[model samples]
Target: MEDKRADVQELSDFELYVYETVAEIDKAGGAANIETLRNLIDRPEEDIWAALSHLVSANHVHSTAKGFTLGPHDWAP
Candidate 1:
């Protein structure tokens, strides 16, 4: 298997959870809005959104009027 340590070093467990959940949303052809994301993931609202903020700043995810999506690079920092 490919080593994922370098790719995911910066993300906390919850953040990884959020990121993966977002990917799932993408696979399902759905956007990850705050309300929907909250329901899909098991983390607390604050923690989920907090991870999302980090993901956005790192360019690993992007947000739109509709919702969040996997960013330009899927496995980037």
Candidate 2:
């Protein structure tokens, strides 16, 4: 069977930070707002939002009226 886990594609340090940020937020049982993620990742607001947007487009994250959360497809082994 094809692995249902998310592939750990080669990623830059910043991209990996984004991935970890999403996972952290999920584990914390809270949503990650752009501002909150920015603070957590120690990145600029624009960069954080951009990363979040990329994650959203890649089906790794979902945006709700409140903020962002892991998407249905974001399963890691």
Candidate 3:
């Protein structure tokens, strides 16, 4: 059997926060732009940008016309 668990990666606290922010955006029936995400996370804009960049690259998050969103990997039921 394939070990699916091994394919999962760990997220740093900030990265997890960034991902969760995007998830909340999904929950609210909308997306979040960088400014809105910044306000929600209360971190330096640069840091948020960094985390978002990484998330996007990893396919854990995605970018939308409105802002950021959870990538397919993080999609929920």
The per-model lDDT (C-alpha) reads 0.80, 0.71, 0.76
Residue-level error in angstroms, candidate 2, position 55:
0.6
RMSD to native for every prediction? 6.0, 3.8, 4.3
Per-prediction TM-score, please? 0.79, 0.72, 0.79
Following a full C-alpha superposition, what root-mean-square deviation does model 1 have from the true structure? 6.0
Ranking by lDDT: 1, 3, 2
Candidate 1, 13-50: lDDT as tens digits: 88888988898887788789999888887768998888
Q: What's the distance in Å from true for residue 13, model 2? A: 3.0
Off by over 4 Å in 3: 1-8
Question: Which model, 2 or 3, shows the larger TM-score?
Answer: 3
For residue 51, model 3's alpha carbon misses the true position, in angstroms, by: 0.2
- Poorest 10 consecutive residues of model 2 by lDDT? 1-10
Model 2 lDDT per residue over 1-77, tens place: 43243444744567668877877887788888877886777767887877776677666677888788777653563
What residue runs in model 1 are displaced by over 4 Å at the alpha carbon? Answer: 1-7, 74-77
Residue 41 in candidate 2, Cα distance off native in Å: 1.5
The digit string of per-residue lDDT tens for model 3 on 21-73 reads 88888778888798888788888999999988888877777688888876665
